[model samples]
Target chain A: MSDKKISKIKIGIINLKTNNLYSIYNAIKNIGYNVSIVETNTKYLNYDFLILPGVGSYAKGMKNITENNFNKRLIDFILPGEKKILGICLGMQLLFENSNEFKMTKGLGLIKGKVKKFKFIQKTIIPHIGWNSVVLNNKMNYFKSSLINKKFYFVHSYVCEPADINYCGTKTFYGNKYFCSSIIQKNIIGTQFHPEKSGKAGINLLKSLLK
Target chain B: MRFIRIIPKLDIKNGQLIKGINLEGLRVLGNPFEFAKNYYESGADEILYLDNVATLYGTNNLSKFVSKTVKNIFIPVTVGGGIRNIKDVEMMLSSGADRICINSSAIDDINIIKKTSRIYGSSTICSIIEVVKIKNKYLITKSNGRDIVNKDPLEWAKKLEQFGTGEIILTCVNHEGLRNGFDIPLINKISRNIKVPVIAHGGAGNFQQVLEVIKKTKISGVAIASLFHYGLVPKFKFKKNRIGNFNYLDRVKNLNIKHTNNLKKLKLFLKSNNINVR
Candidate 1:
């Protein structure tokens, strides 16, 4: 797509009341795209892309989405497969079938996966805070060559495990184990890391995918 | 593999970026937004804003600046100083802060860490433990080393981690702004004992010290001030009418500081030394 065409694409960030949506909003806006914070009541069809941004517990994330009826709205919006959706951090985890955090909570089930806490071992941090490198999957080819082995900001205890290996776009190593960092299933995309907070590389990744 | 994050810590006081020696005698730098933008552009893994006077003033005044900085910079921003309750944490997060660093409040009430961490996940809460060495004992201090807490530094760090703090920012009061080096022994002890990531702050004079700290200790990141701040002093044209003392800005211009202003160069230096850095 041309720069002008990319600029005209309307992006609606789904507000789950998880955490700050401004970082992703500002990031997408900085990329010259028309973006807005859309709630469950907002018209999802108005935008070409819908971003589910979240940072909190999995149970609370699902509760807010179900209570606010975002789950229904999101399902309808992305069911056509023509429109794209992006899930960030806990937002990404909520896209799975279910999460083992706190209690066994049902997710949106857009992707065949489950969220589980990292098993603690020697020399492994619980939350897995700070910047870690994401080794992009070669078979996916969703990310550009430059993003291969690029470091993205990650801060979370639980990780998403896709049933099919093909859906795993990127994997990062921590706690002596590798977990899915990004998922790409047709028009659906999710990143466990905060690409908005990944600085220049992050902005570039968003531009490449969203554009 | 985990990349050691190089964070540029901007100490803010009364809406101006300031740096002090041993956490005292604050000197105003140029605009913090400009500095943050520059650091973000230069590949700083994260930007940390510590409101130097927030504890004394009873409220954090960095929300406006945090909101403004996050508009252009696409990186994790951590806001510290004077975060007492859940409301303060919410305000900072709403203002675009990815993480809230608490020092005085955590010292005043250790349970505040548990409460905030439970509400906002442990990863969002970063506990800042400012340490001062007196009579060969490392004691934890609050409010930027203005008040001394009777708790041991290592024990306090362990307590903070147990209370659900995701990260610990260990700031050495004696080595801050001196541009000498980091307290390696203290950093290693705290980081080795705690399960959460530890970010070493204060006493970063050059790239070698940063490299030394990371190599010697298990620190996830290094929060630098003078080494990077002084190198950029010559780059910015500070307005004379700004708040705080601008006199230090002029002196730092000619100051022979052996440091690289560019973050990429520091990363390259670390990379050359086989240290994984982003």
Candidate 2:
């Protein structure tokens, strides 16, 4: 997490046909790193980190991965290979145990969490969109000192509730409650917010991910 | 609260970027993609592209414009104008738009808002509530201020929040393109009452006006058009200097004006004014 030299950072973006991967792909590439669009169902593992970028329903996203047999390759790389993975939005939800988006759909189970809809006490907006501040649960060297209080772009109806509080990397308040905006455990990290679309702060966060 | 978002609202009609006074007397600008890229590089927080004629024309090729912008601009892009149903929402999102702004269509059927929020989430949808002050009352207007709805603006704001919209773009049609400053009372009323973030748009002529609106109202962001497009506020400028080599404003058969403070300068002004920005 220190200010180590960023060199030879080979990142593979697992492209699921259902999601829009352009912003994230360009964000990473613009940072002067080697990024390849690893199409679904490929056995490509010659990379440092794998990014699962997703949109659309959780069921459809997972179906796209399983249908193309991409889930097997992903599980293999993350488990035995111990390679790091970053899941965004629906991709992040896919890292959980299950989601009730459309129905009870199984996820990658990389993180022990469940995606639940926002339950508001008073009248509130469903999709907690726009720029909102996130409180960091634990400090990480990858982020600058001033990064914690800055607002990050968030657009989601459901949030991931991690089973272990320690896994909650950052939390944001929306719909009258605080929910996990991101979770980190070992090499597996997931964010409900879209870092690629979050502008400069988001770009900085993505750049910091490069080892 | 974090930094106040500064969004450059691009009004597109028939595939080309255009500017107008009170959403009428349209004048063509330049390429939207280029404008978006310039704004992104100049530190714009987000880009809002309003398809000014989508609802009137009943066409849906805005996705193409959105796709082109998405390729180069990395900031969040919110595409509005003529978004009628869930299909239009899906098309925009798929075309690389981060969020969809709904206006007349949401008023026609509240169910669409609920349905879209259910499927895509509320954050993906932004409700544009345009208002016109008529005799001490703020009434809702639709179809780009051509049609006036009977509901009160406050009541409509409350309804949109109840319908599960992620954000609200409260544009004062009366003040839009006027450079007379924002309708602070209207913005304060809705923003204070609504739980979701309210993006205050229209009547923002310069950086100081933007700061005044932010200090006066509890708005989350400011959406600007002519102020950013022409640089100096057209009305505020006393000098009659011609702008653009090709008379860009007159291309759409409009007045001649110079482009002044670009997005970069506006951000600097905001920063100097102690207003936090991206």
Model 1 docking tier (incorrect/acceptable/medium/high) = medium
Can you write out model 1's per-residue Cα lDDT over A128-154, one digit (the tens) per residue? 877888887757665765477577889
For each candidate, the DockQ is: 0.76, 0.41
Which is the leading candidate under lDDT? 1
Regions of model 1 farther than 4 Å from truth: A43-45, B252-262
Candidate 2 deviant stretches above 4 angstroms: A1-18, A32-48, A56-73, A98-106, A116-128, A132-139, A142-151, A170-180, B1-3, B135-137, B232-259, B265-276
Question: lDDT per residue, candidate 2, B176-203, as tens digits?
Answer: 9988899999899998898888999889
lDDT for B185 in candidate 2 is: 90
- Global fold similarity of model 1 (TM-score): 0.95
- Chain A TM-scores, per candidate, are 0.95, 0.92
Query: What are the clashing pairs of model 2?
Result: A127-B122, A127-B123, B231-B260
How far off is each candidate at the interface, as Cα RMSD in Å? 1.1, 2.9
Task: Give the per-residue lDDT of model 1 (tens digit) for B104-176.
Answer: 9888889999988877788999999999999999998888889998899988888898899989999999999
